[model samples]
Target: MVTLTMDGRKIEAPEGATLLKAANSANIEIPQLCSNEELEHYGACRLCVVEITHKNRTRIVASCIYEVAEGLEVNTRSERVLNVRKLVIELLLARNPRHPSLLKIAEDLGVKKSRFEAEIKGCILCGQCIRTCREVVGVSAIGYEGRGINKRVATPFEESPPDCIACGSCHFVCPVDVIPMKEKDGVRNIWKTDFPLQKCESCGRYFAPVKQLEYFREQYNLPPEQFSKCTHCR
Candidate 1:
């Protein structure tokens, strides 16, 4: 265990826990958008920046990825930290101008509107979908393409990803509803790829995707009859 001072309150956290997790445990409101508890702590979004003074040296770091240290004095809402967080909100607002989440964060930070030109691409490049697909779903079907302002999440060669299972994990994890996916006619479409749904014999309902079932079978060595029914019916 490690103890730290966050926002003038002494808090204790488990060893190797990041400042964000510790702050969360203490109910400290450190605004963050590009982080999820189920996923690894990535400092892609700098909104969680906090001023920390350790050994009389102070610096700002993304709380989500910065590990909590013993005797660390942290200021989560310092003027410098607020400035950094507000600026990050503005930048994300520019990318997805009308996104409700971004707008709410801006409101909380006293950022009424962004000064930058609006792109309205609806993707803040938080890498949530990419990370979810790679880390949780175990299929790196989509990834960043290009660099700087041109960078975006896309499939290989902007073509249909052959390895995608149409499981909707990326879509489910996306903070912004940018990853377009639809299911109809027993087919699930995502990443410009179509996957047929498997019918459950017991319920006669289109439940799981056939490709995802095949992937589970391959990865877990499950029997073919295991996927014959959906979880609700099995």
Candidate 2:
């Protein structure tokens, strides 16, 4: 366990836990965008910055990736931290102003507008989808292309991903709500590809993508009849 003083409140966190996790456990509200409990720590959004003092040296760092330390003094809402958060929020707003998630963070930071030109990419490039697809979904179907101003996530050569299992993990994990996963007529569509939905044997209803269930069955080495029914029916 590590005890840290955050905003003058002494809080205890498990060893090696990030400050963001610790703050969450202690009910200390900290704004974040590129953070998900199921995914690995990725300091991409830079909205969760905090001021920290240790050994008489004070510096600002992203709380989502910075681990807590014993006797460390932290300030989640210091002047410098707030300023940094406002800048990050402003940039994110420029990228995706219509997204309600980003707007709420901007409102919390008191960022009314952005100095940069508005570009509605619908994506903030938070890397959540890429991480979810690679780490959780176990298929590196999508990844970043280009660099700097031209950087964006796309399938290989902008073609339909052949390795994708239509799991919808990336769709659910995307914080910006940019990735669209549509299902109709027992057909699942995402990333410009269509997948047939599986019918639950017990309920006679389409539940999930057939490829996703097949992938699970193959990975888990389950019996052929195990996934005949959907989770609800099972």
Candidate 3:
């Protein structure tokens, strides 16, 4: 176990655990995005920055990816750390002023406004959706395109990607709620493509995307009628 002090509270955690993990183990709250316990640590979101002191030196680092070391002192709420985090929140707010999730985080961080001009207006481009799609869903359908001021996420050639299973993984993982998706009249629309909804045979209610069902059917060699009923009905 590695022992560390977070905000002056000593904590013992498993070796190689991240500082964020240590802080969380001690019930120390640190705001973050692009972080999921089930996924690999991605420091794209700068919200988890914390000031650490070791060997008479102090520096700020992203706690989500910073490994905890014995005898290290971590100040999660330091003034410098708060300033950095507030600046990050302000920039995020500037980019996505209307996003509810972003607004909520900004409010929690006491960032009521942004000094920067709005550009792009939404989609902080944290890549949570892209990483979740690639790492968890095993689909490399969506990815970042362009660079610098033109950088953004899009399907291949900015067109409907053939590999997209319409499983809603990207939509579910997006922090800014920018992934386009809507369900209506037993159809699911995503990224300018509409997939028919499959109704549960037993309940007569839409339960799964038709393309997703077909993908499963082909992958598992199941008959067309096999998964007509949803998991609940099965």
Candidate 4:
């Protein structure tokens, strides 16, 4: 454990823990996006910036990825940190003005309106979906495209990649809910591809995507007749 001062409160945190983890251990609230405990710490959103003083030098760094060090003095709510965080929220607001989470965070950060303009439709480009797809799902079906303002997440060529198993992993991880996966009637639409949902053999309720069940079948080497029924029915 390493002792550090966070927001003037002395705290002890496990050594080598990220500052975000340290702050969280101390119950110090730091605004964040593009970070999840289950995924790698990506400092994409720049919302968790904090003021850190070490060896007489004060600098701002993203706490989600910055490791805590001994004798470090961290200020999570300093004016400089607050200003940078607000600016980050402003940019995220510009990119996703109507995102519910973004709107709520912007309001909490005292950001009322964006000074910048964007044609954003939901995605903040935080890469949670991308990371989750690759890391957790082991399917690199989705990825980022272009650069800067032109940058966006999409299947290669903006078309559904064939490797997509219709698992909807991207849907659950998307912060702004831009992956466009939906279920209606008995069809599961993901990206630009629609997969017929399989109904439970016993309950007659649509439960799983056909493509996803097929993928599972291939993974487990199951016979086609086996997955005809959903997990509940089987």
Candidate 5:
């Protein structure tokens, strides 16, 4: 355990723990976005920046990735930090004027109106949806295409890629709800294809994702002897 002082309060934390994780553990309030326990610490939002002083030198750093060193002094809510955060919020607001989450954050930061015109893009490039789809669902169907300011999440050929399993993991993880789910009759529908699930002749068990034994055989390029292994056919 390592002892660190934050905003004049001493707290004990693990040696290698990031400042944000330790603050969260100690119930210290720190505002942040682009941070999730399920994914890596991206530190893209810059909302959790804190002023840290070590040996009388102070600098601003992202708390989500900054390690808590011993005898360190951290100020989570200094005036300078707040001003920087407000400007960050303002810039983000200018980029995504209609985004509800961004609007809410700006409101919380006490931004009345932006002086600069809004650049207005739907997605914030947080990468939450991409990480969730690739890491959790194991489907690399969608990805960020283009470069720099023109970058966006898109399927291959701007159409649904064949590799997509229609898992809906991307939609679930999106913070701004940029990815639109297919809706029918005011209800969002997941991928539901009507495929025959015949009982395996050998095992007499139902396996829906595999569909019929013959269909699985043809799709998987299995040998004829593998028919007995099919739960529906077995």
Candidate 6:
């Protein structure tokens, strides 16, 4: 355990814990976006910045990624920090004016409206949905394509690639409610067709994402017999 002082209060945290996690443990309030407990720490939103003083110098760092150190002095709600956070909120509001969570955060920060033009993008490009789909669900169906400001999330070739498992993991991980799952006639749908009941060659039972079975077999070099035992067959 390591002891650190935050906003004039002493707190104990385990080693290798980030300042945001430590604050969360201590019940200290900190505003944030682009953070989910299920995914990795990505300090993209710049909303959790805090002032930290160490070795007689103070600088602003994103609390979500900054590790807590022994004897560290952290100020989560300083005047300068609040001002910067307000600006960050303003920027996000400009981009996502209709986002309910962003609007709530802006209201909490006392921002009435945004000064800049709205940066309207269909997806925020946080990569939470994509990473969760690939890493946790083992489906590399959707991913980021293009580069820089033009980047967007799509299946390979902008077509629903054959590898998509249609597990809805991406839909669940999205924070902005961009990816939506639709059901029609008892079948789930992504961008294109509704999920079909793939009959197992052996068992003849219906299953979801028939294509996923084919991709799995090809990817893992499984024999034809193994393919028959997949959800389609089992």
Each prediction's RMSD over C-alphas, in Å, is 1.2, 1.5, 1.7, 1.7, 6.5, 4.0
C-alpha lDDT of all candidate models, in order = 0.89, 0.92, 0.87, 0.86, 0.74, 0.80
Report the lDDT tens digits of candidate 2 across residue range 116-224. 7998788999999999998888988999999998999999999999889999988988888899999999999999999999999989899988888888889999888
Quote each prediction's TM-score.
Answer: 0.96, 0.94, 0.93, 0.93, 0.76, 0.82
Per-residue accuracy of model 3 over 150-210 as CA lDDT, tens digit each: 8888999988888888999999888888887999999998988888899998899899898
* Clash totals for all candidate models: 0, 0, 0, 0, 10, 1
What does candidate 6's lDDT look like per residue over 214-233, in tens digits? 66677789876665544433
Q: Find the candidate with the highest TM-score and give its number.
A: 1
Of models 1 and 5, which has the larger TM-score?
1
Q: Check candidate 1 and list the clashing pairs.
A: none
Itemize residue pairs with steric clashes in candidate 5: 199-232, 200-232, 200-233, 200-234, 201-232, 201-233, 201-234, 202-233, 202-234, 203-234
Lowest-sum lDDT 10-residue window in model 4:
225-234
Cα lDDT of model 1 by residue, 133-206, tens digit: 88988888889999988999999999989889999988888877899899999999998788999999989899
Candidate 5, residues 40-99, lDDT tens digits: the string is: 777877888899998888899999989999889999989988888888877777777777
* Candidate 4 C-alpha lDDT tens digits along 75-128: 999999999988889888877789888888888888899888865657888899
Give the distance in Å from residue 148's predicted Cα in candidate 3 to where it truly belongs.
2.2
C-alpha RMSD of candidate 5: 6.5
Candidate 5 — which residues are off by over 4 angstroms? 185-234
